[model samples]
Each structure stands twice: as C-alpha cells, then as structure tokens.
Target: MKEELIVKAYEVAKERYAAIGMDTDKAMDALQKVQLSLHCWQADDVTGFESAGELTGGIQATGNYPGKARNIEELRQDVLKAASYIPGNHRLNLHEIYGDFGGQFVDRDQVEPKHFESWMQWAAEHNMKLDFNSTSFSHPKSGSLSLSNPDKSIRDFWIEHTKRCRAIAEEMGKRQGDPCIMNLWIHDGSKDITVNRMKYREILKNSLDEIFATEYKNMKDCVESKVFGIGLESYTVGSSDFYTAYGASHNKIVTLDTGHFHPTESVADKLSSLLLFIPEVMLHVSRPVRWDSDHVTIMNDDTLDLCKEIVRCDALDRVHIGLDYFDASINRIGAYVIGSRATQKCMLQALLEPLDTLRKYEANDQGFERLALLEEAKSLPWNAVWDMFCLKNNVPVGEEFIAEVEKYEAEVTSKRN
Candidate 1:
C-alpha cells in the first residue's frame, strides 16, 4: 500500500515538473530521492515542523498530504496515527514532530512557556522520546562566553536552561507518567585554541557538572562523541568519558549513535568496551549518507549485521534504540516506514546469524531449549519477540536483559584473563 502511494506520488510529481517545462532529469532525481527515502528501512517518517500557518504553506508547496489537514488538531491526529503505524521498538527522532509544539531553538526570552508545556504533553501522550547529539541545547550566551574567562551570567544561563528542562519534565510527569527524557549535547569547547585546551576541558566539565547536578540529576545522560572535525573536536565525552561520568554521577550512561565514531573504529569492540563501563546505553540508529550523523537513509546490511551481533551479545536490553533523523523534506509516514524496516531488518539479521544460538545459550544461563515457544523464539516475528521480551522481562525495549549480558561479558573476560 505504501509503495503504491509512493509510486503514485512520484508519477504525479514527474507530470507536474514536465508541465512546468522543468528539467525532467532533475524532477526524476528528486522523485527517486523521495522514493529512496520512503523505502529506506532506518528512516524515521516524520512531518510537521511548521505552525498551522507554515503547515498551510507547506501543503501548498508540496501539494501533498498536509493539504488534507485543515487545522492544528487535524495535523496532530495525523501525526499520532503516523506514530501508531510505526513499529513499537523503532527509535523516533522528535525534532520535526515537536518543532510546532514549542521546542524550537529560539532565544530563551522568546520561548513561550505554555507552548513548551503543550509540546511535553504531546510527546508523553505519543510515547515518543527525544535524543540530541550536540545541537540539542541553545543559549544566548554561546557567542559571549569564553572558556578562558567564563562569565557568571553564562553559568547562570546554563543553570536556568537546566531548571526549565526539569520543569518541563515535571510537567510531562504530571500529564503523562514519566519525566522528560532528554539527550544533552554541549558544544562548550573552542576550535581555534591549542595552548589553553586543558582549561577549556576543565571549564566544559565544570559547566556540565553544574548542569547535570541541578537539572538532570534524575534524567539519563547519553554522552555522544562528535568526530566531524580533525580530532579532539570537543570535550572527552564519548563512551570513555561516559565511564568517568557514570562512575561519578548517578542516572547517567552513554547513548551511542553508530555513525559518530571514525569509520575505522570497530563498532562491536566499542559496544563491548562500553558495556564494561556503563550498564546501559541508548542508541540512535541511522545510516550515514555522506559521512553525516543523522541521515534518514536506509540501513545497509553491514549495519544490520552489527546490530545482530549486539543482540546476540544481549546488549539490546541495555540500549534504548531510536530512529534519529533531522531531515525536514520527508513526510512522517515515510519516516515511520524507514524506522520500522530498519528495526525489522536488524532483528531478522540477529535471528538468522549463526552466533545467535551460542548467544542464546549464554543468555539463558543454561543449555538450548526444547519447548515450542523457545524454538519459535528464534523465528517469531521481530516485533512479536521484542514485545514478549518487554513483557517477560518487565523492562522496556532496549533495556531488557542488559544486566545478564554485562555479567556474562565480565565472566568471559575474567576467564580469558
């Protein structure tokens, strides 16, 4: 059904472009790009990064589904229905969806408190979570604050941001059941300096300590690495940095996005090493389109294979998986399809992997199974198996069986040593 819709949309786009005397090749290329994005398994199909007015403009511009949604309520309903169609275990990026809900990166003074509250409520009701890399937080003091002589006002600004986050969490808790689960990304270092780099590091740490101590005392902190630049782009806050932070602070862990590391970095080894440091980690699952972190592209087989290894190692229980994307062009339905397919493909890879049997043996703490359910567990549809794991283990997806996996790894490492 989705494929048919995509095909029809492509044909209509082609005809419109031809009628306008536009370049057929460019139109076909755009159509193919949209189709590819739609078909991609790891993409999070999301829409509505605009207000009711902007959405009206988008509807006219795209001549797409947004035309059907006349009002804000209608758009909200459309987003909810789109979320429902997406897989339960799939990780969703909230940037596009919640932009209209009042979580924009505008100046602190301009933020409408009521709009922010409405946004938090919407997220809770949808059961969707937000994850940020480094672009998550914005501050007016960013341009003014120097790491060498950090201003008191800069510190105060960060503190206020933290307080606002906590207030939002509390609001969400009041409306929903849990506090706001936010991913903190701080770009607190300078790129031009080399002599006083250590000072910058200390300042960044102190700032984060203050932020975490006050606002995120109870929230999960996923420390992600930014490797876009040559080297040492920011503070030491990747998996290794997370170890120190987790050792020092409570309710903290690493959120590992697969693309953040150097291409040469061994992902399997990285995952195993992180397990030794922190008991849990969150995952942002996306394929790199041109060496980018959050491309809403299809998951390749190699990525699926690695995900399989992680599952075979029983790391899913420790990692919360989310579909992380920031592209505004793709529709919400497309995002859902991509995320669902990525998750499904990854699960299928895990089940079919030869290592799965051995991993199961290690996970169950005993020999292989004989029951029909046990036999079917290997081939039971990915969604069904994940649901059972959620129910049987009493933990949400990506958090089930993490302790056991870490324990097994410890034992294995101990014996090897």
Candidate 2:
C-alpha cells in the first residue's frame, strides 16, 4: 500500500481508538516488542537433516509441496526470506535433527554444541536468537518411548539427548544474551490400553528430574504434553494433568501447544491458572481442526481468545509465544508468513481492545453494557493500525506480501528440482 494512504488511515484509526480510551501508539509499540519464535521445520516439512527415515512417533506431515529445504543453507535462506516479509525481529526455533553436522552422522545422544556451532554463528550474523527442541521421534528407538520407556538403555539414550539439547540451549542463550526456551516434547504413549500408567509416569518424572538436575542460568526448561499421536491413540504418557502438576511442583515452565489438547478444550482458560503458579509459560501456537494436526495458525476465534487472555492478564512478557506448525500443502514461505502475521494480528487486536472500560463495567455489575461494548469493539479500525505497523516496519502492507511470496517461489523455490 502507498505510504500516504497508510498515514491517513492510521490517523483516522488513532482518533477512533482514542474515543474508546485506547492508545494505538502504545498498542503498536507492544506489538513490536513481541518476538515470536518461528519454527524451522516449516521450511522442510519436519524432514530434518538427519537420516531419511520415515516420520514415526505418531506425527506426520501431509502434502508433497515442492521447494522443501534439503540442507541447512537452503533452510536458513528460506527462513530468512520468510522473516523479511514479517514485521519485527524474531527468534528461530531449531530441532535437534536440523543441526549443521557437516554431512557427518551425529546421533542424538552423541550430539553437542559443536554440531550447532555453525548455526550459532549464522544466527549471530543475521542478528537473530535461537531456541532448541529435543527430537524424540522418527528414530528406531522411538517406537516404544523415550523418557517414559521402561527399557533403561533406550531411555538413557533419549535422556542423554535431552541433556545435550539443554546444554546447547544454554550456550545459545549465553551467546545471544537472552534465555533460550528449550522445549521438550516426546511422542511417548501406547497405541492400545496401557496397563502400567503409574509406572510409566514415575519413570518419566525421574528422567526429567535427572535431565534438569544440572541447572543453567541462560536456558529455561519447558515440558510439553500431548493428548495423543497418529499411532498412539489410546493413551498419552505425558497428559496435560501430568505436565501441569509437574511444572507447578518443580517450578519449570510448562508449554501449551494449542493442538496438543482436546477439540473442545479452551487453551485460553488455562493461561491464568498456569501463570499463577509457574514462573513463565511457553506457547506453541497452531491450528487443530479436530485433532493434533498441527495446521497453520489463522486469525480465528481460538487464537483471538488466547491473545486476549494474555493481554488481559498483563502477562505479555511472562508468556513466550512461538509458532509450531508445518504445512507442505502450500508454498512453505507463504505458510510461514501467513501464520506469523496472523499471530501478530491477534496480538494487535488484543492490544487494541478497550480492556479498562470493559473491566470497569464488569466490576460495576453492568453486564449488559460490558457485553454491548465488547460486541461493538469487534468492528473497530484494527486493520488500519495493522497496515500502519507493517508500513512502519518497511514490509509489504496488506496482501502485498502474497505477491512477494509468489515471486520468491517462481524465482527461487520452483527451480529447486
């Protein structure tokens, strides 16, 4: 969009929001401060740089979209291209399998900070921070379980892998001068009924205790729980209850992946409860149609409510937001831009809300007035402010980013074959 039109529209939007006791400038500033952690797997459909093994562990990435990144350079280039279209500075979330190992096979347990030295240097060059995750699936030993697995030798391997990942995350944080959110998720469950539920959880708890025994000041440990996976339909060893209880008791950050819950469950409602106990929370923002499909996030009601809750609770700095989805059905870069922008839009909408007025009405027992004002706030000039934000950030405003993605695909990704 033209700069003149954006400026005019923003002026009008600023006045409109001012009438509702909202400050557009403050909202824009808050939006700029939110540094979303973009997932690296989105560029390559979770097919990491490790072996060409089939994706196991109850996870799968559908669609055969072309131009998937084949190596570290291509992946980083694709991510950089996607980041250019986004507004603010962001962090890159990396899985253990995506390390730059120089064509050498560094198994999970044998991996170290040296395997990721090139990545750290690359991130430094790009002025981007890094986050880390332990890859517990798509391996030979992943069939049974990792941390929760009863077999000591198999479990020990994964435990070692997670420890190394934490160490790597600590080093990343130390290098970047910010805490690296190291998230740990495992597809550890049974396809059928599991008889020894207590035993499995106990073993998993012990494993986590050992993994987190050596504390690092630079990295924050977050434990993620899943409802189920593709093959593990009957029971998930690390259910929501287990992780919530563990996180609260152990004072560790708990990760809430929107797709990792039941269809009818409200992820937003748990935010307040978790904030009261845990020091911090990590959010894996995604869209789940009816299950844990890991679809690209959109500016839907679910996402809106999540953002609203975060703003309402005044926990913006406490809750770390990150994208966690891989959809190969469309242009990979397009998916990244769309998901990240949608999330930012949600945050903008939340920031533009007349929260003070609404809360005052509620406190005064004026339910009808509060509901009426909220309904009226829905059609406010949020888009104008969003456009202004993009304009200020020097990115393509509105749907202009679509053309940029198409151009990239034609000139860059399409020739990958």
Candidate 3:
C-alpha cells in the first residue's frame, strides 16, 4: 500500500473514531505494545531438534507442508522472517525439545541451561526474550501418565525434567532481565475408565508440591490444564478446576490455552474471575476446530472477546499474551504472520471501543441502546487503523504480505531438501 493512501485512510478513521469519543492514536499505540510470544513449534511442526521424533500425548500438527525447518539455524531464520512482517517487539516461546543438542542425544531428565546457551546468545543478538515449556509429551517414558503416574521412577523422571526446565527459564530471564513465563502442562491422563481416579489426583498433587518446592526470582511458574487429549478421552488429571485452585492457593500464574476447553465454554468469561484471584495469567491463543485441534488463529469472536476483556478489566500489563498454534498445512512463515496479525487486529478493534459511552448507556439501564451501539461498533473503520499500524511499523500493509510470503516460499523455503 502507498504511504499517502495509508495516512489518508487513517486520518479519516481518526475523525470517525473521534466523533464517538475514541482515540485511534491511543488504540494504535496500545496495539503496538502487545508483544505476542510467538510459538517456536510452528516453524518446525513441533519437530524439535531433539532428533527425529513423532508427536504423541494426544496432540498432533497434521500436514505435509514442505520446507519445514530442519535444525536450529533454519528455525531461527524462519522466525526472523515471520517477525519481519509482524509489528512490535515480541518474545519467543520454546519447548525444551528445541535445544542446541549438536547431534548428540540428551535425555529430557538431563537437559540444562548449557543446552540453550546458543539460543540465549542468538536471542540477545536479535533483540528478543524467551519463554519456556517442559516437554512431557513425545517421549518414550511419556506413556499415558507422567506426574500422576503410579510408577515412582517414571514420575520422578518427568519431575526432574520439569525442574531443569525452570532453571533454564530462569537463566533466560536473568540474561534478558525479564521474567520468563515457564509454563508446565503435562499430558498425564487416562485413555479409558480408571477406578484409581482419586489415587492419581492425589499423586499428581504430591508431585506438584515436590516440583514447585524451590523458588526462582526471574521466572514465573504457570500450570496449564486441558479437558482431555485425543486418546485420553476419559479422564484428565489436571483439569481447569485443579489448575485454578492450585494457582490461587500457590500464588502461581495460570495458563489458559484456547483449545483446551469444551466448545461451549468461553475463555474470555474466565478472565474477570481470574483477575480477582491469580497474580497473573498467561494466554495460549489458538483456534480449535471442534476439539483441541491447534488451528491457526484468526480475528474471530473468541479472540476479540479475549482481547476486549483484557482491556475492559484494565489487566493489560497483568495478562501475558502468547500465540499457541502450529499449522503445518500451509507456509509456516505465513502461518506465523497471519496468526500474529489477526490477533493484533482483534486487539486493535477492542481498544477502539468507546467503553465510557457504552458503560453510561448501561448505567442508565438503557439495554437496547447498549446492544445497538455494540452491533454498530462492528462496522467501524478499525481496519484503517490497523493499516496505519502496519505503516508505522514499516511492515507490509494489508494483503501485500501475501505476495511477500509467496516470494519467500519461492526463493527460500521451497528449496529446502
């Protein structure tokens, strides 16, 4: 898009929003501040550098998309390419598997900060911080149960691995001078009916108590929960209720993955309640097609509501935003750009809302007026403000990124062996 056209469109949009007592500049400023922690798994289809491995733990990234990143260098290059198109300085979220193993196999229990030394150096060079997750899935010992295992040896293995992961996150945080959000989500559940449900839950609670025994200053620990995994359709040891209570009592951050709940559930609705209790929240923003299918995120109602709730509750700094999808069916870099841009767009829309006017309408008990304004807000010129955001960030404006992504595929990714 031409620079003059973008500025002109933004000026018109600024006027339109001003009439309704909304500031487009403030909305754009807020949008730019949102640093989405892009997931590293998306570039390589969750195939980490830990050797050739198959995805397990009831999660899968289904696609035969060529040009997948084969190693650390390629993955980092792909991430930089994607970030070029996205606005704002962002963070990178990593699973423990994507370490600098250097062709040698390092067992999960033995992972350390040295394995990620090169990553920290690289992130420093490129101006990015990092977040982390403990890899409990896609391991031989990850047979249905991990932290909640009846087998003490297998359970201790994962516990050791998780502790090591926290140490690594702490190192990253110290290096970057920021708190790394270390999220712990175990795929420990039963695929079929189990009579020892109470026993497993008891064991899991004990395991968590052991794992979180130590305290770290540079990293925040968060517990995540899911309804169920693919094969594990019967019972989930760490359900939402479990994590919520655990987080509240322990004063730990809670992570809410968008695809982890039932279809009827609204993740946005949980924020107001969570704000009253938890110190902080981490968002794993993804699109779920019916179940826990990690599809690329878009500017849908779920996403808009999630962002709006953050703004409405005045929890912008308190809530950490992150992307959590790995769609290998399309261009990986393109997937990253699309999901990041879509999320920013939704946030932009939410920020542009004339909340004071709507609240007054509600305070006056004007129900129909509030409803009417909401429906009308949908057609506002938020897209023009979005275009201006891209303009200010010096990124490709509008559909211009489509051609640029294609060019990258033709010149770079498609040539990968």
Give per-residue CA lDDT, model 1, range 230-297, as digits (tens): 23243332234533464336546666566666666655556676667676766655555545555553
- Which digits, one per residue and each the tens of the lDDT, describe model 3 over residues 1-417? 388998998999999999999999988888778899999999999989986878999788889889999989999999999999998899999999999998999999999999999999999999999999999999999989999998999999999999999999999999999999999998888889978887888899899999899999999999999989878989999999999999999999999999899998999999999989999999999999986558999999999999999999989999999899999889999999999999999899999999999999999999999999999999999999998999889999999999999999999999996
| Candidate 3 collision pairs | none
Instruction: For candidate 2, give the lDDT.
Output: 0.94
Model 2 stretches astray by more than 4 angstroms: none
> How many backbone collisions does model 2 have?
0
From the highest lDDT down, the ranking of the candidates is 2, 3, 1
Shift in Å, residue 117, candidate 3? 0.6
Worst 10 residues of 3 by lDDT: 285-294
lDDT of 1 at 258: 61
After superposition, candidate 3 runs with Cα above 4 Å error: none
| Candidate lDDT (C-alpha), each | 0.44, 0.94, 0.93
Q: What is the lDDT of residue 38 in candidate 2?
A: 97
Off by over 4 Å in 1: 1-78, 89-114, 120-140, 144-149, 178-180, 191-193, 215-218, 229-251, 328-332, 352-356, 359-417
TM-score of each: 0.58, 0.99, 0.99
